[model samples]
Target: MDLEATKNLSASHTIGNYILKSKLGESSFSTVWKAENKITGGEVAAKQVYLSKLNKNLRNCLDCELNFLSSVNHPNIIRLLDVFEINLGMMFTEALLLDMVLRKSIWSSSASIMLEILKQTVIYMLSVSIIFHFCKSEYLQSQDECCVFLVLEFCSGGNLASYLQQHGRVQEKIAKRFTQQMGDGLKILQSHHIIHRDLKPENILLSGKESDVVLKIADFGLSRVLPDNHVETVCGSPFYMAPEVLQFQRYDCKVDMWSVGVILFELLNGYPPFRGRTNFQNIKSSSCLPFSQHILPGLHPDCVDICSRLLSANPVQRLSFDEFYHHKFLRIKGVGKYHGQ
Candidate 1:
């Protein structure tokens, strides 16, 4: 058997040098697994994406993910280790061809005509295959069920979203610590001119044991390199999305600071500052930061100041990356030790 055939047989449990153990999470087009490196005996995350399930926009996001993760190395950002592709099987390809023929109501066509259709379909699949960075001629020959696997550093402590769910609101000192790490990561992104359009708690991960867990930013699916000109793409989760993005205005990296503010607010208050059933509702409700009456009075003045400025409705008034990174709130020292509530 050839390499593709070998891959098809083993890919259910293994890919490259990693043996997939259990599923970590999944989305519409991809699944992430916790895997063990066979040679090094280390843990890692294996994110697998099915090419057939991707649309044009999703493909672009995948390209951005691969490009950004491959280029950067930061302690506060998730690291990409390896990437590879696997072909499902020839049987799967034939099944897809049959399904297409049946859908078109051409099942009773002549063998020569069916052969022509099969050839055309194979050509189409191959054309789509070229969009991937790791496309191999041999892998394209299978013409169906190709999966791209991204090996990444594993975070054992789950995401900040789940952490928040388990611990509710965190103390100011802990929240500040998390904010500082996020700032450190954003500094790297700023240097690279990359904007993490999605910066929710779900995309920030905890990577160590309880006593000394470190926060690392993950999930770059919505990230993009901002050029000199602004981009008007209205993308990102509504709750943490910037007001400018929610209003569909042209935006730059300052939009990310707005998201950071939302995350910070959520960290301190146990819920986002704004709640809405739709984007318009979110924008309408977010005209002002609705700090909890009970919690607002107790927060430090600098904390309140930074949050208010970062969450400013106008991007121009919002804190720039440099300003945010060096804000007095993040630079403040000598806070009392925080014991979890």
Candidate 2:
């Protein structure tokens, strides 16, 4: 629960040539750390996970993450450098050396610098392949405690949540910059058949510069590879989730489109489309609101139209990924204007 206690428990733990320096992050099933390797004298992000803590199904999910990272060759996605086995109940993942960018943001002096970092991050994501992998070694040790560790790119900027908190709501000009880059990133993902089920401000991490803000769609725990036909999963955050998901209907990548719509809406509206007194009720009735009425009168009608189609409850009627690129909102935002009209 406390930092000191965490050090006490994992202080003696070692994975091959890397010595655990200090814990950087800890979740219910895994812990990440900043460590220096004695063999290479280089710093690396080490994620230690207890596979025994995961249920059978979730253990399989962890495998999905490992397999995805290992095989994927994407600048935006985290790289898996090496893996280590710890006794029978634990395993440590040594990811490609990367710093905690969130902590780096603490040194940033202004919001402009932070936005620049976010801009570069989104660009990096555009150049890589979204691959999938599976790690069975942890599961082999202990099914009950199995877990997967993700070592990602070190963006000097913090997450979108912290960026928003520090800078508050962004100006229209700034939001357009973000929307353009984010739209580009989403298009790349769609090309690869990966749907980022969770697409919210928090998941959209910044690099650490106002003009250099590059956005990366992180945290694919709820994401799924579309089958030849269609896959169904009733999962995602209440506020960013699509109406079809909330209704428990069969949906495709359109769910992700819905999330993007919500984000764009928030960028202009200064709040998520759905917020309720309680999360339980919020999930039940959030996506039903009409954006046109709630949106600011100054927003271009085309922008509102594109967002409206994206938020449509009917997946069939929702804006397709291709259509999104050519939408009036994207055009007004200067997304695809370079090539032609």
TM-score of each: 0.79, 0.70
lDDT of 2 at 17: 74
What are the lDDT figures for the candidates, one per model? Answer: 0.81, 0.63
lDDT of 1 by residue, 147-227 (tens): 788999999899999999999988888889899999999988888888999999999999878777799999887788787
For candidate 2, write residues 91-159 as lDDT tens digits. Answer: 211111113234445688888876776565545433321211133444344532333344444455756
Cα displacement (Å) at residue 5, model 1: 17
Cα error, candidate 1, residue 282 (Å): 0.8
